[model samples]
Each structure stands twice: as structure tokens, then as C-alpha cells.
Target: MTPKKEQMTMKQMMSRRAVVRVPSGPASIETIDVPVVEPGPGELRVKIGAAAINPVDLGVAGGLFHQLALVDQPDYTGLGWDFAGTVEATGPGVELPGGTRVAGFIDGFDRDHGSHAEHLLVPAANVAVVPDGLDLVEAATVPLNATAAAQLVDLLGAPPNDARRLLVTGAAGAVGAYVAALAKDRSWQVTGMARAADEQFVRGLGVDFTTDLGQAWDAVADAGALQEDAFRAVREGGRFIGMQPAARLPEERGIAVEVVFARPDGALLARLLARVATGELPARVHAVAPLDEVACAYQAMAQGSIRGRIVLVP
Candidate 1:
């Protein structure tokens, strides 16, 4: 009799992964079969349930990173950042039992594989247990953007008594909304700059909302990647935090320019996920697509104006 799938070992399995050989655009995406990898010490092999398609993924597929010379791969470049899954196998020093629901993201541009796969091997310390009620698709959207927002706020620090006014550009975006909401805890008089249509959503975060990029703010969080336009909105001697790490804007008018580059932190992600489950943080999904339809999904996202993430289910 033939062995069932559940009876097979990792070494006996082949997994499908999405990759970009040339990275011309979404049409260049292709899936290839590869041997399943076993988790090493302090690692866990997760059976991915969902992975979110972000702007970064689009950039990877569209050759943005390649143009910057940030990618170096002989075969193909893996495309994906965050995922939610169940622990299928554990390596030495991992206490999490098999079947534990978890969510996390890998940080970097150059890689042979990423979360957009049937199976992934990640450090146990880089993943957090997903809350009981949160769906894996929703959990997949939290790790990368939220971590980036939190880290951006860390650079913003506490607002000074004399300079408490802050403007967050792209307030309707994943990173901006989180920064708009979290910056309030640090005593910032927050304002959100978004489109007129996004007023309701931006205002719902308990911050002031405006469509205009007003000048003379204490700080400007350029989550929109407005670059020089957003930087110009900050007052003299104020702070300006940006999302683009590779293309940082120059400082002028004595404004402090800093950029956020998100890193993986399992313990911090646990707290963030708990907050997401409790409605303290926001999780939005634009649509869901099967792994086979990744090319279509990437094409849709590349058209721009997407409010929520498109999740890929394997």
C-alpha cells in the first residue's frame, strides 16, 4: 500500500514555491518544485496556510530591488515577507508542539525562499503563536507592517511639550494607520494626512484627519513615501521619519531624517498579535487568492490604490 501524505517524512516531500527568475514584472512569476527542508536546531517547519502580498513583494516581482542592486541570486529570487501557518515539525530546543498556529515574517530582500511556499523553515524565536480567534489570513497581515510602524514610532520618541503636533502621511496605509494610533500613546497631538475618501477610516483611529499636507508640524511620518514633498512639511529642527530605507531623503531646514527598516521579533509580535485579536490593532484583507493565482494577484496589486492586503492561500 502507498503511504499517505501524513505518513511521509520531510525528506520525502517536494514543495512548490513562487519565484522570479528575471523579475521583469508580475508576469515573470513562476512556481517551481523543490525538496522540502527540515528545520535545524531552534527552528520550526511551518505548513503555511496564508501569506500576504505586500508592496515589497510587488517590488520584488517587478524588479525594483534588482534595479537597486539589492538582489543577488543565481537561480531565482523568492518573493514574500509574512505568513501564518501551523507548526508541522520542530527541531531541537523548540518547545512548541506540532500544530501550534503561528505567524511571522522574514526580513531581507535577497533569499532563495520566503513565506510564499507550502513549507517554510524559520527560527522558533522569529514566530509568535496566533491567537485563538484570529484567522491565519488576518494574522498574516500583521507582522511586517506593524513591526515597521512600532519601530518608526520608537524613532519618533515622546513628543516634546513645546512640539507635540505630528502629521502621519498615508494615514490610510497599513504602516501609517498603526503609527497614527500608536503615536498617541506617546502624547503626540497626531494628525493623519490621507485622501478625502479615507477621512472616515483615518478619523476612526482617534486622530485629526486632513487631505492637505499642511506645513510646520512637529514631525512628519512619511508612510506614504512622499519623499521630498513629505519632508518639506516638517518644521525646522523637527523630525521626519520615512518608510524607504534604500532611498532616504536628505535632511534640510535642520529636520532630523530617519527611516524605518522592520526586523522580526517573536516576543514583540506576540504582544502585537494579542492586541490585534483584542481589536487594539487593525487587520485588513483586500482579497484572497490561491497559490496558483499569485501572478494575477500581483498584477492587481501593481495597479495600485489597494487599501488592504491580498492574501495567498496554499
Candidate 2:
């Protein structure tokens, strides 16, 4: 005998969305009627609760990934990489029910859909269960920043001779702060670069010390400019990980300089979320705004020097 099919609830679907084009104009939130996106195989349709605004989002809106995307999708793209939401529908081969809370990111260059909307569709492998006692709002901020930090540390590899001294430029920023904390947890002696005002906060994250680029360069003659300054405190042969992608750092005096660009990884994100719930790592949030205020969120990020992430609640 054939089995009965499960009933799926359908609601009036209108998604206020943010769209970016190849010309790369600024992104603004606009309310418009949107078709309900049925999940394909290995996909889930989530009702987005919150999404975080990252600097890369702005980069995408400015057409940074346009060339990469055109090879796959030949049209205007959507933005928003990080989001937390409830599963509203499951596609073929998906096991999660219609109410499971989860968080994840869409590859900004994927060009399918993004998180800045009432509903989002993403791969099942790209999401992790939100841990108990963590707000979806805060969980929304983790996937991108934490993943970036993890990737940077991973690139640095295991410390040599069981003696680890690491330097993190932009340590007070979102990605850098997490890097410092995570490296500290791994028994690396961390020296963070941040302005004097943030010394207390940077040290609170378990960093052994904090200094600015000026202070780091004063002793090193700014070899290779600000990035190489990070090498001043790092033990010779130690690693210098930089958060700024555009900045160039020269390898000098046996110190290695590397730049990290965070990519989406659901499995690693799941582990990081578990750490947050257990108080092993902290998720810092600067502010929360409704999705309608997405422009303001972007503007705030552009102004610079916000300690944590700005989350947009849908």
C-alpha cells in the first residue's frame, strides 16, 4: 500500500528583499511581493529571524564578486551572507521538520538567494542547529566572523616546538577578536593590535597584550608598512595573521604574514556554536536593527570601528 503524504502549510508569501546588481550600487531594503521559493533537493526554506551585516556584504553590493558570479548566474544577485531562522519547509532528501531553528550563510558569490529577506533558501549542509540559551539574533552573527577566524588560525597551523606566539592585526574587530580568543584557548601567546582605548577589551579576550599599529611599527621601521608591524611582537618564525584583505604585508625577519578571507563551512560553524553555548567563546554584538533599517546598518559598518557585529532582525 502507498503511504499518505505529509501536509505542508502555505502562507501568504511576500519577502522584503535586498538586491544587488553588476553595476554595484548601494543596497537598500525594499518591500516587494516575492514568489515562495520551493526548496530543491538537499535544501531548506527558512523563515529568517535575523541576519548580520558584514563588511563583505557591502563589498558584494559594490560588485566585488560580480565576475565570479557571472560564470554561474547571469543576472543581478542578492546579498546577506549570515542568518538564523526556522525551517519552514523541507525539500527532497531533507530530514529536518518545519520548525527546527537553525543558522547558516549563503555563499555571497553563489547568486541564488541571500539572507536579507523574510524567507531564505539554503543548502542543508550549510546550516547548524542553534544551541540552547542562545538567541537566534546572536547566533546570526557567528557563521561568517567565527569561520573567518577559524580559517585564519587553521592557515597558521600548529605552533612549532610547542611554543606558540601569535600576532593578530585588527584584534579588536570582530574576526580578529575571535582569532585572539581561539588562539589563546589553543595555548598560543597572543599579542593583539588595537588602539589604546580597546586594550582592556582585547586583553579580556585572553590576549597577553595589546598595541596599536603605530606602537608596533615604531620599533620595526614599518617594514612592509602597517601589516609587517604585527611582526614586531611575534616571536621570530611565529605567524602574523591579518584581517584586512586589501592590505599587503611583507615577510621579514623570518616572520610569515598571511591574509584570511572567511568562507562558509556549516560543520565548523556547528562546532563554534556549541562552543558559544558552553561559554567557551563569546559572540559579541554591537547592535540589533530591524530588517527595514538595513541601510542604516550598512552605513554604520561603513563608518568603521564598531567593536562587534550589527544584526538585522527580520
Candidate 3:
């Protein structure tokens, strides 16, 4: 449907603390006040109640423009995306079910300033109203990963049955965990790869099996490119999905390796929320903190010790 918009004037800069990466290293939370912007046509203004810190936050905070943009990129940016909050106003013709509770993917990857603030203005088309009773924190964590997984399973020409024998790296992580659960729930035989330490954790997620990354490689050689051997874990023609695509899969194996770049999708996200409402989807508590704690959260991510999602509450 065409969206409705809200207008504003007498704008002033709004200070927001973001995980910015200067040339030196990780940036601390600096309050940056951008001039107050009214929602333009097809746009909406969100009073960001929470924003989650993703791995992307770390890269941007370190000034890795190329990585953030997925290429030899343009402008540098501050960290964040993945927001959960309320609609403040909508731009011309952009109707957002006014005051609706929503969570949508951050356009931060545009390599510009992002959702790590008290307020954010985004394209109305990019958001979805979060279901009632869902935790806003989980809402912040669901976007990027869920959107990508849906694309691979629904958009990539892969039938649900074809998703069996799935192998997901970082399976114990936020996105990976969701992928592992959704695929299994859909009747796909799933196997998740994580550090040996997380074997039990991944198994508890109801995956068909778990591969301890440490043990698999020492004996497997091309273990890094497990595509050929990975299919053996499933029925014939099973697919291998990866956040980072491994080396080529030998054609003889009929193993399809899907490399993904997931964005947020309101429709798929709503489906996930429906699952949450139905008790089919498990929402794990990663870490919950206020916006001021974002700096510490980024530090934990950089050190590689955070066990779950890091959400910033405003």
C-alpha cells in the first residue's frame, strides 16, 4: 500500500551517541546531534526505544568502509541498525499505523549514521509493526538475520525440502540460531557448526546434529570447504548455507552453497513474530543494556565473548 507521511519544521540537530570508528580505533559513544528531519514522502520517524549492536557495529566502529559496504566503499559511518520502537510521525502519504510498536532493519549499512540514538527517521516501507507481547530487545535482533534466511529459503529457488542437511557456521550466534531453528521447524534436517564449547547449546536448539568446528577440520583437510562432505549429512541434493561462503563445492556432490547478504523484511519478520506468539520460535536472551552501554557492548563483541544479542535501550 502507498504510505502516508508526516511533516515537521524548525528542525535542530539531535545529539546521539554512536559506535564510531575513527582512523585510530573503536570510537566511544559521541553524542551527535543531527538536524531534526521530518519524514519525507514514503518516510517515517521512529522514536527508537532500542537498537541492537551487531557484528556490523564492530566493523563500522573500526572504519572498515569496504567491509561495511561489501566493497571498496564510499563514506565512513557510525555504528548500529536493528531497531525496535514506536512510530512518531510519517512523511507525505506515508501512513504508519500511527503510534504502532515496530521493529525494522536499520539502513546503517548505507555506511552512514544509524539507529544508535533516541530517535531515527527511516523509509516507511522498511518497517513492520512488532507483534504484541514480544520483547522489544528480541525485535532489535531479528531483522538482518531473519531477512537473509527467508531470502535463501523462499527466494533463492530452494524448496523447503531442499533446505534439509543445512550447515550453518556461527550457529550458536543470534542469526545462526534463528536459521537453525526455522529450518528445523520447516522439516529440514539441520546440522550446525560452532566452537566445541557451544556444541550442547546448538544441539539444544533442536538441530539434527552439531559439528564442533575444532574437531572437524583437523581430520577433514578440505574441512574448510565442507560442501562435498556436508551433503552426506543429509539426503541427496541437500543445500549448504553459509554467512561466509566456503570454497567451491564440487559439482559431483550436487551441493548448493548459498552465500547470503540479508536485509530486513517486514513480512518475514512478522512471520517470525507469529511463531513467537505460537511458541514455535525460541527467543534467546543475549544481552540487554541501555543505549549508554553500547560502548561496552562493542568492546565485548570485539573480544569475541558475547554469547547473544546486545540490545541498546533508549
Candidate 4:
């Protein structure tokens, strides 16, 4: 069913708990009611236990994406994306039944129903079972970040076989760190760009070089003028995957620069979830808070001061 449905066939559903943003000039999270959803075809309604607050959550809370939202009144939006929860119900034509613990990606629903809730209804295309022996809180963190990293290396054109040199921006953060680690596993040489204080941390993530944009990716003459040295490091045809827009152009050097805006994908999430279960990857849970603290969680993201995932507990 579409997000507008008020009630469903299941009458026993609780009006789920959620944190909604009320727009004045600033943003804050407040308690709101949500309907218990029955999954339609290719749908899954998760009884959310752990949901992570990410940058998008903060942006939605602050109304940073009002222009991008398909629905207006995004100020009244629900504000979380990453989650680890259990299957409360499955829609028609599904493989698994209820009670499967899953972690997957979520794009906020019409700027309204996000993962910062007691229960969440997510598309079947964005789900997978949580890896065996994985902590639910930790499992919530992997999906969005994985999608961002994977989009650059997997969805976009990155030569899989070559030992290419690549640049990762925001390398000390969750997504970047995971990207660097994953690159190492895939035999790519990784150079991580971060503030000096985060150098060692980035290096620990299996990155070969940790530098500020000046040394790592090369600041490129204050980001306005291009530097030959910077171009040389990436080599011709090397990739630059980043969350931020490049302040300068890379085409001058024939380098491929990709801006990866993350998306939710259940199939991808299933693979990542499988990797975590197989001990090929690790997921980290930074903090866990109840749904009421979603505002604080979003605030942490907006401030750029978080180290790992922030979960909203039911």
C-alpha cells in the first residue's frame, strides 16, 4: 500500500512510535503516531529495534532537502535511514516468513516515515537477514554506507582486476573507512583524505596514504588551481569516490571522479549482510538510543562529530 493508508487488515497493530521533525526555524524531534503496516507485494514491515541516524536524517530534520523531497512538508518528516529490525510481517509472494531478523537500507517515506520509529515498513528491494551472530545495533550501520561505497566501486565503472590507486574522501568516517577497507580486500590501493587528526585512524583502515586534501588527494592549489602533482598521484584513469562535490574539476587530468549519493538496495544489502555473516566484513555500532533521542542523533550527524552508527531503539 502507499504511505497514505490509515489502517490495515491487521487490527492489532500498535500505532508505532516515531520521531517527527516540527519545522519552526530550527528542527527538533517529537513523538508521533504511525500505523502498523501490512506489507503489500514486495514489501516488508519491520518491527524496528535498532535504526541508525545518518546525514540524511539530519538534513531532513533541518529541512535541508525540502527541494529534493518528492513530498512537501518534509519538515514534518520522519528522520532515520539505516536500521536492523525483525520481520513482523511480509507481503504477498515472499520467500521468508515473519521473525526474520534483518538489516537494510531505507529511504524516508515521502519525507515522512523514516527509520526513527518503533516499527518501519520498508520496500522488499532493500532488505536482508542480519548476519548470524551479529549485534542488531551494529548491523544497522552497514547498509547506507555500503550503498555509497558500492555505488562507486560496483555500480559505477571501476576496473575490478587492476590494482588501481584511488582516493577516498571523508576516509575516517564510517562510509569512507568501510570503503577503504573494502578496497584493500579487492586489491585497490587506497589513499584516504581526512583532517590530520584522523590520519592514523584512516591509516588503520588499510589505507596506504592518509593526508589532508593537500597531501593525500592534493589540495590542488587551494582547490581552485590544478596541481600536476595531484593529478600524478591518482594516475590517469584512477578513480575518486567522494561524498562531497569536488571543489575543482578532475577532467583536466583524465581522472574519473564520481560523487556517490547513497541509495537503498535490498539485494546489495543482502550481499553485504552475507559478507558480515561470513566474517569477511565487520560492522560497528557507535551508539544506541531510544526513538526519542533521534533529534540528538541527527544533531550529532549535522555537526560532523560522530564516529559510527547511531541507533534509535524502539
Candidate 4 per-residue C-alpha lDDT over 84-188 given as tens digits, one digit per residue, 9 for 90 to 100: 888988888777778889888766446567777777777777788887788788788888877767665663343455535566666777677767677666566
Clash pairs detected, candidate 1: none
Off by over 4 Å in 2: 1-11, 22-32, 64-75, 110-112, 213-259
For the record, the alpha-carbon RMSD of candidate 3 to the native fold, in angstroms, is: 6.7
Per-residue lDDT tens digits for candidate 2, residues 186-220, read 66666777789988988888775556543322112
143: Cα error in model 2, Å: 0.7
Ranking 3 against 4 by lDDT, winner: 4
Error of 4 at 139 (Å): 0.4
lDDT values, one for every candidate: 0.91, 0.72, 0.63, 0.65
Ranking by lDDT: 1, 2, 4, 3
Q: How accurate is candidate 4 locally (lDDT)?
A: 0.65
Please report how far candidate 4 places residue 193 from its true position, in Å: 2.4
TM-score of 4: 0.79
What tens digits encode model 1's per-residue C-alpha lDDT throughout 52-135?
A: 999999889988898888899999999899999999999999999999999999989989898888889999999999999999
lDDT tens digits, residue span 1-314, model 3: 22322222323345464635343344444555566677889889888887887776676666554443443324335567788899988889886777898888865344556888877888777888888888777777777766665665553343454233445556777766776676665565556787778888889888745554332211111222354444344344445454432444453345454555566667777887777656666655577777776677677667876676778887
- Show the lowest summed lDDT stretch of 10 residues, model 4: 217-226
Give the Cα error of residue 15 in candidate 2, in Å.
Answer: 2.2
TM-score of each: 0.96, 0.81, 0.77, 0.79
**Model 3 lDDT vs. the true structure?**
0.63
